[model samples]
Target: MKKTCVHLMLLVVVFCLTTIVQNRAFSELDEGLGKSLKQDSVDVWEDFLNTLDRRGLSDPHWELESEDKEKLINYFKAKIAASVSEGLTSLPERLPSYVHRFPEGMLQTLKSHAENVLKVNPHNGAAAKFLAVEAFHKVNTQISSEKYPLLEKAMVLAPNDIEICFFAYAACTRLGDQTREEALVALERMLERLRGGDHKVSYLWTVRLYTSEVAATPVQIYLKINKKHPIIDRWEVVLTEILAVFENELLQTPDSGVFNIIAYIYEAVGDIAAAQAVFKNLKPFYEKRLAENPKDRTALTSLANIHNKLGNTDLAHEYSVKVNPTLAWEGQVLPEFSPVVDLDGKPVSLADYRGELVLLDFWATWCGPCIVEMPNVKAVYEKYRDQGFEIIGISLDTDEAALRKFIKENQLPWRQVFDGKRWEGPLAQQYGVRSIPAQFLIDREGRVISVKARGKRLNALVEAEIGDTID
Candidate 1:
């Protein structure tokens, strides 16, 4: 009995000791892990808020003045530091609420701020489109060309997002190309939900997207009849709200922002004249801003782009010169594109073959059609070698090594240039090359009479031009 009691006591002591050690170790480990997580959360939160702070959104740009801008700006710094003390899994929900709690004007500004430097990090594969569009709507115009590209990527990344696609619609119209098919798909989804009773903002936008050229009749009818109706006039309320949003910001300022959105809306609604008048007024303002800040390359570039789009070549060229004096335009009388040497550092010019009939063929290594007909090109060149015909081949091969290998293997008996820049030489831009396999059959005088000739027909056609062919 005494031995059994002693053994039982021994077991009880071992169990108590083991339990104590485990609980103490676990407590220490939990404390350490909690500290580590707190540090990580603080770092991420601070980084996220810093991005917004840089854009002047944390304190709100709309309400800034000589009095409180500095204090508010500093507060963004302080608040960002404070936010790091929170948990990560709670951030997404917390962030939206935090934004909502911001001063009325700050929400829009924050949205804009968030867009410029989206949550790009080690894991972010794309810009946050939903965040960007929410911010973009608050601004008067696009800040950069990159925004359009970002919105496009966002639409692809989140195809079901309707609000993101709405901004995408505006971006496609502004930027041109690449998003048409995808944008159409998203618009159809939005259209399925839209009713004429939803309001003019939703319905009119649907009409613009669905109807290639929106008829003026329905818009005129909407304007005349819907001004008094509550649901339909909600669009007017939105316009009013936008005005309020920009009013304080542009108040007593020389910003033609109010007019710009009105014009954009008018243009979107098929009212060309209204859009034109507003755009015309704003154009001068933008141009004047460029004049005031001669070093504002962005402002100058935008003006030049607009002019170029409008077919005002001379004005466009003039403004483009302000941003970059050397970048040549494509559609011009002089050569705008020239081939660089891929290997052997070769250089050929139109002046080199002044007396010879030059068949300047723009070819490429990646161009399948160009490759398929290269043998024929070689045969023609060989036949015309002694006939005062200079077949100067320009390979638009982007890769120097690839071009050289192709040339070496083929044993092409022709002088060629393969320095892979495109549509930027004096001769190329003059000729207006829009497609591959484009050839300029120039006479001995260096005057091109025909272009876009290919295959055996190109050789015969060139020969006929030089009075060398029987036909």
Candidate 2:
């Protein structure tokens, strides 16, 4: 019995010693981790301060002394080198604060930081996300071959990040000639992730995706006919896949926006029967809302527009009357505008072209539809300039350089109003120009003749009105 008691005493002594050793080790490890976290926090603050100082020098009015500039540059270089040497593992955590302080001019630095992190740890998802955003920014500025490999790498590293996946899909779609299959794969992955209940997929991103896919279908068809592009050889199959995805999305939530997109996609792909069916399905929803409230402008306008598109002109006219009873139709005199200066500091006003028919064209260089219609406008101007036809272009372009370049390249001889405030320029606001490529035709008496004149319709209207004077 004494021997057994002695054995139990030895076992208790050993257990106590082991427990004490473990407790000491854990306390030391906890201290070390706390120190590391504290150090990281300090580094993050330093990075933010440096970023702020760098940005402060970016102001056009703020001129930095050569010595100060050199010092700042060297400081940043040293910091970046240190971060790279340390593998930049903590950079992802610090990046958000740094970016919030200085959002501009940090792309290259962030790209380098992410690359360094990936070199150290290939599975760094946050680093991969930064790289993906950098690539997206690059591609949006202009299509390039550099964005794809980075996007592919990001997808492989962070397969579940919705933003990364969406960006990859965007890059693929933008450069669709070579990346159609990749786009499909990225889109599929995005949808799959969305289905997994990740609410991180934003509403705007979803809408953009739907619009891009639908828009690409028409472009692909055009390319196939014009260029015989083999990239879209299996466009029908790809379009079917896109339709399936849209149907699945609609099933999840019967959104009017999604329904509209699906209908457009169907029309673009030449599925008229399916398009009509979808439109018919949407008719009841709008009608139900209108029945609840007859004066709902949104419902009234939607019904009018859809019916007009479907050639139900009687129904369209009925809804249109309900929406606007006064009929501010063509031939009504438009509001007069005071004098505004053109880009070259020349004063212009509606009265300047009183003796001639005028076209007040509200447009912006950045607007896609406006750019697409510009050639037609130029052609019309050239054809009718000798017939006392004048154009007064009101540009909503904020970038002065781009506007000037576009005008010079296209040789747009018409006077332009450019105050550098997009959408809020004096003429744009005065004319209630909420959208671009807004056209208004003025008769020789300065009375508005047609407000919706565009393309061949504009050509016909001009020819009809000015045909008598053409001799």
Candidate 3:
């Protein structure tokens, strides 16, 4: 009986001790987990701050070494993983706020993180929206395909996000898949959301949506090709709404950018009378500025450009002279330059093309207008090659492969200068070339005949100059 009692006590003690050990193990694990979550959040926030600091200094990710870029991406990836592991539902909502802070090099990693979020929580609308944005950026960079489906999914999930609707509209327009009615619906929704809000933000979004080169070019091309199409009627309606918004905002605050955009929208939709009225309004504001500060170069240049566009040539010339007495206006001698090398490592220069009527062409492969005008340029080149006509193509293409492919495919015979820097190229800055498809018509004596000739005007100018030599 004594042995039985001792054995029973030993068994009870062993059971109690085992239970305590297991409980202690679980407590330690819980503490470790909490510490890990805190540490991950700290690390991610630190990385976010570092990223902002780098971007604030204008440090481009492409300039970073591969290892450094990989480290940054890994940081983001680890943060995302930690968020998922912790079951943090707010992460989807928070992650997008950091998207634009990172460079383009982190796009793929971001996309992956978004995908993982969606995998864990299929209803994560914010994650879906971010993925769509990433896809749009990729498309802009020519690195991805259409993301309309992803956008559509995001819209279905988050039906009230007007920003998502705007992006969806942009995606559809870029894909050339949305009809006039569909596009109008998206625009109306965007306008509805924007109504009675901060006018500056509204104006900024309006400019982004309707006035950018990417958004405007296709619409302009379509209207040019199909003047009487039913879509034009719908476009007219949308433009009227957009104008009303701008006019209402202008009534509250007379901003110069808003005024200029109002005129631009009017001109785009073929409303010359309204456009003239808007420009007519601009003169008083500019005159007031000039009266206050006579030598305000910015105001002087704005007037000169606006007048030039309005075909008030004498006023334009007057302002141009005020801005710079020795400006390289038409009928003036172009600034002299030494030789610059061509893409083939051959030394060629504007001086080399002296004694010939040269077309100093500043363009880029990515420029929609430049691409649209290339065939005409090619035809003129082929026809006028035998004459004393020359064309010097100063390409602002950043992609070497794309530039080389375009030149080879088009069989461009002109001498091209390509330094793989878009607007910051040396010659482009020297001549003050701000926009693409810019042309300078230089006579045989290297005198500037026209500084902004383009399209049909360029064709006419070139033909007139080379006509005598042709026959």
On TM-score, the leading prediction is 3
Where is model 2 more than 4 Å wrong at Cα? 1-102, 105-108, 120-126, 138-143, 174-182, 188-208, 211-242, 245-252, 292-295, 317-356, 360-386, 391-438, 442-449, 454-471
Tens digit of lDDT per residue, candidate 2, span 240-329? 555665677677778777777778778766788888888889888899999999879889988987887687988987887677542343
1-471 per-residue lDDT for model 1 (tens digits):
999999999999976975675455444433543433223434434444454555335554433333233333233322322222211112232242234324545445544444443443211212354354444443334453545555555555544444455555544444333433333444444443342323444534443432333222222323544344544454444333333333333454545545554555565445667666655666777778777998787667767755664568898878876665323322222342354442467666677777777777877888888888778777777777788776767766667778778888999767776545665544444454545676666666666645545687867865776567553
Order of models, best TM-score first: 3, 2, 1
What is the Cα-based lDDT of residue 118 in candidate 1? 46
Residue 251, candidate 2: Cα error in Å is: 4.4
Cα-based lDDT for every prediction: 0.52, 0.66, 0.68
Candidate 3 structure quality by residue, lDDT tens digits, 1-471: 999999999999976975675455434533543434323434444545565545354544424445445554544444333322222222333343345555565676678877987797676665677677677643452432444567666666665556666765665565543334445566666676677777776766666665442343323533553667666676666677677777877998888877887887788777888888888889889889999999988789879978977889999989987875434557987877545778889987667878898888888888999999889888777777788888988899999788989999989989888888787888777776667788788999889888666677777888898774434
Return the TM-score for each candidate structure.
0.33, 0.53, 0.57
Candidate 1 residue-pair clash tally? 11
How far is 9's C-alpha from truth in model 2 (Å)? 38
The candidate with the higher lDDT, 1 or 2, is 2
Estimate the overall C-alpha local distance difference test score of candidate 2. 0.66
Q: What is the lDDT of residue 179 in candidate 3?
A: 37
- Quote the positional error of residue 308 for candidate 3 in Å: 5.2
